[model samples]
Target: MSPRVLIVGLNYSPEHTGIAPYTAGMAQALRESGWDVEVITGLPHYPQWRIHDGYPRTGDPHEVIDGVPVLRVPHPVPHDAGQLRRLGMEIVFGLRAATAPWGRPDAVVVVTPALFASAIVRVRAALTRTPVIAWVHDIYTAGLSETGAAGGPVTHMMRAVEGTFLRSCSGAVVIHDRFADYLRGHMGVAAERITTVRNWTHISEAPTVDTDALRRRFGWGPEDVVVLHTGNMGAKQDLTNVAAAAQVAERTGAPLRFVLVGGGHQRPQLEQLATTTPRFEVLPSVDNDTYAGLLRAADVLLVNERPGLTEMCVPSKLTSYFTADRPVLAAVEAAGPSAAELAAADAGIRVRPGDPEALVEGAMQLHDEWITTGGATHRGGRRYVREVLSRGAAVRSFVSAVAKLLPVTTEHRAPATVNS
Candidate 1:
């Protein structure tokens, strides 16, 4: 029989943005790899932080997607999440999901951001003699600290618990080189135990859409230099800098308009800011195809990070942005992973965070450069992503890492049902 694999995370698909798509893609790929894979996750309430309309707020049960069994657990959805409220919700979900009847498995992969629940998974794996892999998407404590959500007795306690969980897991996986270093240096996880499997874009390659038509539809004219930032608008993004830069561009009479295209907890504040800022526009999330088209259509794609976000995690959107073959302008820490990736790929320009002047200057410079060179400088990014960060490459690395931990068997038979 094939090895039965169970995945635990706080997010999963039908939710197109954030960590959900990656988790869904990983699960689907594992199923195709001949593993009997299943997931134990919360009802989708990411980015917006409110449960979707049709799904029950509580007692959400098991459902199957593309042949993978998903066991949904109940958890509170925080409308306006602060540190304490977010921690509380994650704890609730972790407890409920830990006790969920997910059945026996040869191995389990617990996804982080669900770090509040890592302890339960550790203990359960220990008792059941099942190996567990911590598939880390972010360095949780570092992320919390960088996002201004850490530094308290609660944070101290949680950090200790998280470290313990990391050490206890059979192995861990991180998405960036910086993440691997953070795990080793900050969390004190042994260097040999962590594997860096870079994230792949969940958005597939689709035929290009009518760029001219969409530009006109969104009120962009030939003279308007559109700078688009697409994806989750969360605290980590520091989008206030974008608004400030828009103001700067306006005051200087630069032919620039900044559009933030996505939704999240921070969207309402950005929306309020847009009401008074003429050069700033906020649009809701689009379907995957439209998202791809918008990426292709924009004159410049922006990746703006909060000031202190050095290396907590790599923004998953960068993969898609690179794949779109657009010039990226990242306002992030100079030595950070995002900037480093841009430097390595020669994909885009980077400036320090919180400098609206720098942002305006960078945008104007990139715009001029694009026109002069006809985007020759930005062509290498897509080739880099296709060669290094493709979907098949990532999943194969993930499978190889976990395969070492689980029992090796040759029989490839049907997956056993949970109740069996």
Candidate 2:
């Protein structure tokens, strides 16, 4: 009879991507706090657009990871990034929602990777009258259309879908305040019903892998200064700036190596750019464990995004870099949400977005500074993440939000997420 919470999202880990880490961490955190939590999601394959490396499709349809029950239903592997492919994935998961056997939890938390995922949750919630907490990552209608991945009448249609989805929600959680504003100002979601619950990665243990040893395998030298970018290489990230920055490193003999990991629509462009540049190397993504190692391995973690589009999205990669305790060089939209975090954290340097020359100069200078100071030194941001951004803290914030959504129990109130 404990509180049971259901989280629905796409590309959850062992699944890896934006919401994956949050979904996995939140489910485990809620379970740890004595609430029975289950995640209802699609079959493992995303970004790669294939099933997860070792996991196989099963007739049983339900799997468990680290004691948190994962109910995986069928979803299409849409290789073609067309409207049909996108809709195909949403339709399959929406149908699975009806038939998936994860018991109806007292309250449901739906994480939207795509814009239309909310539409599905809205229909289901309306049918059952179940309370739903819609957690907005990036709204697909605006987010993807902004990226040109989803557009035309589809964009208009998605905006309409988002309208109803937000209206149907009992409560809404947005990662950054910009989104909360979007929900209220644009989607007509009431401000009182929305809360800004920041996204963060929770770590139980600090990284144990030897970054030097990792570099050895990846063809980077112990003395090499690494500029690592982890997570999606999407259009919005504007990785060409990273490539331009890498060119500066190569020219200046800065001994800086740019390692691009994770996948996205912009991956091919980054890959093509890297192919012509020796200082930049493309490494296929490893599991979450190896990804953690890469975070710590880099002397400089690059968290850059296109300028002007900052409020539309916040990079989850910043959480990983901050948690790993590495110095960040964020070349993002000026005065964006992430810039605010970087400034407040005093973590690393920030350059104005889209100015390739400025980005290169800033990156080159930061590389020189790191090498001159001590390449391996951790920053205040790392210390801050340890104190504030830990997994326990993140889950507690999410759990409390879920608890609040569950009619104000007035028992076992959880703490909010902090810089740790």
How far is 157's C-alpha from truth in model 2 (Å)?
4.6
Per-residue alpha-carbon lDDT of model 1 for 1-420, expressed as tens digits?
788888988899878887888889999999988788988888887677788778896553868887788888888888866777887888888888778776678888999967877667667778888888998988777777788786776567767877888988889999988888877887889988899888887665663677778898888988999999988888889899999999998899998999999878899999999999979999987878888888888889999999978878788888888888888999999878998888877888998899999998999888899889977776667888888888999999999888888776735656745332
Stretches of model 2 off by over 4 angstroms after superposition: 80-84, 150-157, 203-205, 251-254, 373-378, 407-420
lDDT of 1 at 183: 79
Cα lDDT over the full model 2? 0.73
Candidate 2, 314-363: lDDT as tens digits: 77877777877777888876667788778766788888887756766666
**Overall lDDT per candidate, in order of appearance:** 0.84, 0.73
Error of 1 at 280 (Å): 0.2
**TM-scores, each model vs. reference:** 0.95, 0.88
TM-score between candidate 1 and the true structure: 0.95
